[model samples]
Target: MQINGAQMVIEALIAEGVDTVFGYPGGAIMNVYDEIYKQKDFKHILTRHEQAAVHAAEGYAKVSGKVGVAMITSGPGFTNAVTGLADAYMDSIPLVVISGQVPMSLIGTDAFQEIDAVGISRSCTKHNYLVTKAQDLPRVLKEAFHIAATGRPGPVHVDIPKDVTAEIAEFDYSIVLDLETYKPHVKGNPRQIKKVMEAIANAKRPLFYLGGGIINANAAYEVRDLVQKTGIPAVETFMARGVLSCDDQLLIGMLGMHGSYASNMAMSETDLVIGLGVRFDDRVTGKLSEFAKNASVIHVDIDPASISKLVNADYPIVGDVKNVVNEMLELIAGIESQKYKVWRETVQNFAKLHPLTYHEDTERLKPQWVIQRVGELLGDSANISTDVGQHQMWTGQFYPFTRPRQFISSGGLGTMGFGFPAAIGVKAATPEKISINFTGDGSILMNVQELMTAVGNKLPVINIILNNNYLGMVRQWQTLFYDKRHSETDLSVQPDFVKLAEAFGGIGYRVKTKEEFDSALKDAVEKNVVAFIEVIVHRMENVMPMVPAGGSLFNMMLLEKKGEK
Candidate 1:
């Protein structure tokens, strides 16, 4: 059967079982858009900006456990999507971006709306292709999907020329090519599994440190099962928020710079750290030499480079996290749980002695309380996302995620404008589930234009803005480290968020007190419309249990008791 390259693109998408595509159209990609218009097989989200399109796709991918697809024209359109590509690359999110390029004849001619799309995207994407031949489009498209979804997933780019899209091609979507060099190890070595089992059995104080790879590998259940069976305390990274239920007894809070006092303390004391699907990023391993100093690490990750790049692993298992963990579980099945009664007691005491506490005043709204309330209101139904700032940390601190991929944030890149657009994608992917964006006053404005995207699609996502009238995170750092020298951090000139939401055709509310917040939240939940609720929080309030940059994790600044060096 013969088909145009544009139609082949659609056929390839259908073959890949892609149900949704987030995109923005331009002259170079008009043919693809025209084919998209003719097709009823997939839902196309027309985002306000090219960046939002990618972010939206990320949100969809994060929750759906599927490779996200994004499409845009070449030149500025491709350039605008760069930040999102970098963000996805950093976080290892699987995304296949199809970009339309200028006609092949215009190559090196500096044609209008032409840029080196493949060259520019090479650094950020796992792999990229420039498809000049129409007949090769199907195989390249298939390869793009495979590359994006395999071996520590990341974005893959495919640049198609306009002339190619117009050319006819012999279409054969049924052919599945297996590239030998692209093989990913899915099983852990038996010897490595035995070593991990030995570590689990020998250690009196065992800890499980996790990251997004668990969720990406669909191994959250295995992680929970491993911890439950082995009786090891666990601390997750920001990207691995919901791997274990928040109320699980063995689960300590997140481990990082803004990690809970208990989690940091527990990490410092552990004798064996089972690092599953996590890279020991500097933020999590503050003052690397001192981080888990007492412990020997058994790092399991699909990416071999991540195993010892930052923190050296005693037992490095290079395979899929799910496979490695499940294999370890099988090996340790009949083994008795270690008698770590003293260790458990110590961990519990640490959790009790330095609990996550804020000045709980009913008069003024605290960001922590607002997040806690949202967590309570949404409960297991919560599918929350966040932009980078104080609010992001606050949600990380207070939001009790009970399921994997329920909490989505740009952990690696810490992109500011990610939440609102991501929330739109989440809503689109799972319309029955409730989606919310916990954003800051500063971060929300970065991609607030997506409010129209939500309204246009009727996605009915709720945006809860923690309005502090300042860049809260930077202000905290300035207050602590820089002698309170407030520079451009103060964001006093802000739009009335309520009116702004209304102008964008969404319901909005501004709440100053807990009573107002509760009411607004209830209204947002019941209304079933795209809504924005701005909760005014204190400007000076900071996320506690913060391990200052270059500071030891053992030495943290608690809100109740600030230790002086």
Candidate 2:
């Protein structure tokens, strides 16, 4: 068969099992968009902003465990995707971003709508290429997908010139991808695995610190099995939330800054810390010297750079998380479960003493209560996305995720306006499962135009807005650290979210009390159309158990009441 480069690109994407793509069409990419229209297999999501398209693709990839794909035009369209590419790079997300470039003949003549996308994205992407010839399209695409999805998983770019899309080529669907420059480490060394197993067996107080890599590698069951077999308690990072059931006896919840006191204490007191697929980010380690001072660290990761990039490890194994865990499991297959009864008892005692708790008032609907109720309603099946702010932290503290990839949020980037569009992407990827977006009043206003996209696509995602009438997180900081002088945090001038939803042709409800919240939630879940629920919460309320910026985890401000200072 023979086809143009644009058609060949779409065919290659279909062959790679890509069924959904988020993108915004523009002048330079009209040819590719036309090819997309001709194809019946792929579904395209039109976003209000090109940036949202990239973020939606990221959310899809995060939840589905697939390489997310996004398409855009040259110049401004390509520029808009830079932030998303950087975010994915920082978080190690798998993404294939295809951008339309100017014609090859106008390469150095400063053609209209022309910018070197490959050059611009090189710093942030895992790999990139400029497809000048039509014959190279299929092979380049296959290699791009391979590189983007394999080890360390990050964004990859393919810059397709407008003229190249129209060039005809012999499109043979059968072609092997051979890239000498690109190879990802997948297998762990047997010796290293044996050493880690021996350390695990000998340690009296061993802990497993899981990260997003486990989810990316689809090793959740293996992780759980290893923890159960060794009788070792496990804690997850913010990005790795829901890797294990929160109620599981061996699960110690999240650790590090803003984590539970018991979790932080457990990490600090451990004899050995087995970190799997997790980077020791500053948010997780706090003062590097003080982090797990008593523990001998064994780090396993696919990216060799991350092994000793932060806190030095006693043992470093570079390989895929699933492969490494499998190797370790094989090494310790028949070993009897060690007795950590004392360690378990100590952790449980701490948990009981400082359990996660919040006050509930019947007079007003609280964000924490709403999140808890939603968690109960959805059980362990629903996928939750959150925007950055007070609601984001509230969801982190309140929601109970029983599996990996069930909780998706912008932890590293802390990008506001990430929730609603992310929920749309999650719903698109998993159409049968219910998806919810927990958003703050300030965060929602950043990309509220995405509400129209949700309604247009008929994606029935429940958007829960925690209306605090101010930027809750910043206001709390101002109140605590800055003489209680609230400056520029007021959000009272914002439009009514309920009316906004109505104008976007979606169902809207406002809840003021607990009863109203419960009723509205129930109604929203049952409704077939996209729904938005705004819960008015008390003003000037702050999130407790806070470690001030650049402060040690041990030094926390436990504010119990208003005006505690």
Candidate 3:
């Protein structure tokens, strides 16, 4: 039963049911990499960079609904993954990042490749530890996985010194995790659940605001049941997209800054706002004071600290999203049927009047048209990941997601280089799923080297590039508010993206016209290799229904001019 810490690490991963690991090996972590090489249980994906490794793990986690595991060396390797840690932290993704540290004896001797792994990752991780003793490997690794996948899940870091990996220890892969301070509240408080049920029963214009927590808690079915039983309208945030189908009668679409007009308007007019696993972030709330101002908020979250952290909740229920929703549904069963005929009519009118629309051009391909066609062709089955900016918004707005975890993107972090690498992770984890990265020209270049990673690993992912020759999102802001001073935003002298893809050992296509795009996209999808299709879209086509920073969601910039549409 005696094993080295490196073997303990692999054993712990196997015990935790971790089948895949995304990482780049380095000298410090070479022992763990050696141990990884000896095992066929865990599939180790060698990403091009440490950042992409973390992102690939994120993609795997998002799709597989499992705790993502990443391994890297100290110093630059750890630092490279900091962005990914922060991104996962911001979006509450469950991840366990194992970093190799220098020997314990060289702690303060300024050892080579030795930076404070726990110190650097402290802010970004939910919890972190530096393991010096070899015997403590099993316990720490077990706790790390538990913490990463537990309540209000986020990244957890475990720093293993190089010497510890060589030390022998009796490795018992037991599940006796006795961390007294780390218990998550999974059951809803009865009194708070009663209040939510009462509110649901009484309110004529009640609205449910769902967040990433719904998907994180795996409570989509409970949310659907609650919405169906109560007949209440629901709107999802960017992180919680696809909780309900776009065509669901009770659904109003995604809400917040770039939210649908109907969804925002409904939020503005509601009397009761049921916050389900949502943090009520600023981007989603726009002007805080004006956000659901007239509504009595009932916030339900597993993390009690999240309650009233931003917007004060009249009824704060601290429990798991699915558990709380299930309890509420059970409590409200057989209650008198509630109707919001007038409110529904008002919301429908809002939808009809201010529908999500964009200018279509026959001569030039618009971004909206491209996204719509992709949705039409692929349907809602493809695993869609996106880098932040115009393409991110377009995917969220246009894609009709019916299943949970169907659309993945950088939500809280708004990370630019997230899409392609994440698609690689998604494809790696779920090879059967058609994974695609819907990205923009500017965002794609951030970590385009990962194209080689995908091709090398034989992870056939499709990257659809919306080439607009400018930082489209920033240009939109400049055009509307900054008097068209498009300083430093022009990316006209960019590399040929088609050639860039081909250079990375992937199939590349340039499509300017709609017909060409359709043909090229179909061809790319059918190809059993990494493919990139660069679709030339108009630079001036802006993502519409914009809510300027700090502006009330009600007061949106619907169009450039009165008669423009």
Candidate 4:
């Protein structure tokens, strides 16, 4: 059967089981959009911007556990999505971004909207290609999806020249991909697995260090089982928030710079660290020398290079997190859960002594209270996305996340304009559940335009704006370290967020007190429209239990001293 490249592109998407695609059409990619117009098999969402398109795809992927697909034109269209590509790459989110290139004849001739899509995306994308021949679409599309969704999943780019989209070719549906250079090892070695189990069994203060890879591998159940069976006190990184429920007894809490005191202390004093699918990032490790200094590290990851990229592993198991954890479960009978009772008590003591605490006030609305209230109201019934900064930390601390893929944020890239658009994507993927975007005043403005996208598409996502009237996180650093010399972080001259929401054809509410907040939130829930609730919070309040950069995890600024400044 003969078909054009544009038709083949849509066909390939259908064959790959892609149900929804997020994108913005432009001059170079007009043909693909035209083909999209005729397709009924999949739905295409026209986001407000290309960046939103990519971020929405990321949110969709995070929740669906499927490869997210996005399309855009060459040059600025692809460039606009760079941040999202980098974010997806850092978080190991599988995505396929299709870009329309200039005609092959225009290569190196500086044609309109022409740029090196492959070159610019090479550093961020796991793999990329330039397709000039129409007949080559099948193999490239197949390989793109395969590479994007395989081990250590990441974004893949496929740039199809404009001429190729119009070129007629023999379209064969079945083509076996010959990917000799790309193969991911999925099973751990028996010897390494045995050694890891032995270390967990014998260590007096064993700690399970969880990361996002467990969620990526869909191994939350495996990890939870291993933790329960071994009775090891576990601590999660930011991206691993819901792998172990916030209420899980075996879980201490999130461990990192903004981590709970107990979680950080446990990481500091543990005798053994059983890291599953973790990257040992700087935010989590604090000072490398002082981090888990007394502990023997057992790192399990599918990517071999990530094993010792920062902290050297004593026992490195190269395999899928699910596969390795399942192997450990087979040997769980050999380990005794009673041996670590004392260690668990010590961790619990740390939690009691200096927990993730904040000062509560009656006259003013604290950011923590807002988050806690939302968690109490929704629990695991809602999907939450957040932009970077104080609000992101607050969500990590207070949200009662009980399921994998329930919490979405930019962990590695920490992109600011990620939350609202991502919430739109989340709502698109799971229309049955409520999607909420917890964003700060500064962070929300970065992509506030996406409210129009939500409104236009009729996605009743709830955008909870913790409007503190400052770049809250940066202000904290200034208060603590910069001698209160607050440079330009003050966002006092901000737009009326509620009015801004209405301008985008959405409902809005302004809450200055906790009492107002409750009613506003309830109203938003009942309205079930694209809504934004701007809750005015204390401007100077900060994320607590902070371990300053390069400081030991054990040393945290527990509480603000009254009248210290």
CA lDDT, every model vs. true structure: 0.91, 0.86, 0.89, 0.92
lDDT at residue 92 of model 3 (Cα atoms) = 91
User: Lowest summed lDDT over 10 consecutive residues: which window, candidate 1?
Assistant: 556-565
Candidate 2, residue 345: lDDT: 82
Better candidate by TM-score, 1 or 4: 4
TM-score of every model versus the real structure: 0.98, 0.96, 0.98, 0.99
Candidate 1, TM-score vs. the true structure? Answer: 0.98
**Per-residue alpha-carbon lDDT of candidate 1 for residues 241-271, written as tens digits (9 for 90 to 100):** 9999999989889989999989999999999
In candidate 1 the C-alpha lDDT for residue 414 amounts to: 93
For residues 1-565, what per-residue lDDT tens digits would candidate 4 score against the true structure?
A: 7999999999999999999999999878989999999989999999989999999999999998999999999889989988999899999999999999999999899989989989999999999999989999988999999999889999999999999999999887698888888889999999989988888878999999999999999999988988988888999999999999888999899999999999999999999999999999999999999999999999999899999999999999999999999999998888988999999999999998877767887777999999999999888889999999999998998888999999999999999999988999899999989899999999998888898899999998899999888999999999889999888999999898889889999999999887899899888888899998999898888888899999988898876654454
CA error at residue 352 for candidate 2, angstroms: 2.1
Q: Say what the RMSD of model 1 is.
A: 1.6
For candidate 3, the per-residue lDDT at 523 reads: 89
Off by over 4 Å in 1: 333-335, 561-565
Steric clash pairs (candidate 3): none
Clashing pairs in 1: none
Alpha-carbon runs more than 4 Å astray in model 3:
334-338, 560-565
The global Cα lDDT (0 to 1) of model 3 is 0.89
